[model samples]
Target: MTEEAQRRLLVELGASLFQRGYSVGSAGNISIRLEDGYLMTPTNSSLGRLEAARISKLDRDWNHVDGDKPTKEVFLHRAFLDARPEAGAVVHLHSTYATAISCFEEAVIPPLTPYFVMRVGRTLPLIPYYRPGNPEMEPAVHAAAKGAKAVLLANHGPVICGATLIDAVNAAEELEEAAKLALLLRGMSPRLLTPPQVDDLLTTFG
Candidate 1:
């Protein structure tokens, strides 16, 4: 796709997430890989109010080359993109329930539903927390992202990747929903999808 089209798509998707409360204020960032570089949401820009023409553009070396400045958490997106060449886009957000799940001792959300198992995969890595924008967490995120579809940041939120930009947004939405379900069933003995069930979903989805 052309850069202009990608920028518009980001604006559309970002607005969708924001209107649904998946993101608030200037608390989230989105990016798509490009043949020569990348296109990312600008620093401190509200996803609900993204200006497609002003989306930040970065060169192959990650240097900002046009439009607005990119998010300070560029390290978060870079880690996943560099680690997984197949990851065409990344979406990082501080959605409510998913952030709550990050604080749990569990490293991953249980297989609560077939759609969750299909979109998020079986192992969701939880990275130790770092102050927002700290590059110190890059190595850990990079390593884990190599083999996982998504990772939760302790006391923070989720970083999801996909083969396409919309896929990333969809997975991000699914994760938040699953997290919400997990919280609702917190005190109850919910029947989770069994190992074989999860495996079947993965095979079918794949």
Candidate 2:
């Protein structure tokens, strides 16, 4: 897609996620990899109100080249994007259920459904808490991204990446649903996808 098209799509997707409550206020950021650089939601900008033309542009080395300043959490996206060559987009959101799950003792969200395993891969590692926007979290996130498509930031939220913007958004949505399911099934033994079932999904869909 052309740069213009990517900008428009970022605005559209950001609005959709915001309107649906996936992000509130200026609490989330989205970034798309470009041939020349990247297009990212501006810092302090509400996803619901993004102007395509004003989205922050970063050079290949991550310097701010145009538009407003990029989110301070640019390093968060960079960690994943740099680690995974196939990842073309990264989404970080403070969605409720997912954030709640992050606060729990377990560092990983268990496989509760076939779709969760299929969409988010085999595991969702939890990165130890780092204050939001702190560059200190980058190394941990990068290391976790080496093996997982998504990771839950302890007491914060989720960071998800995919080969395309749509794929990343879809995975984020699925992750939120999986978190909801886990919360609802907590304290109750719920049927989970067995090892063979997870393997089958991975083999068939991956």
Winning candidate number (lDDT):
2
What digit string (tens of lDDT, one per residue) describes model 1 on residues 154-203? Answer: 99899999999999999999999999998998988999999999888888
lDDT of each: 0.93, 0.94
Output the worst ten-in-a-row residue range by lDDT, candidate 2.
107-116
**Residue pairs that clash (backbone atoms under 3 angstroms), model 1:** none
Candidate 1 local lDDT, residue 190: 95
After the best TM-score superposition of candidate 1, give how far the Cα of residue 95 lies from its true spot, in angstroms: 0.3
Clashes of each: 0, 0
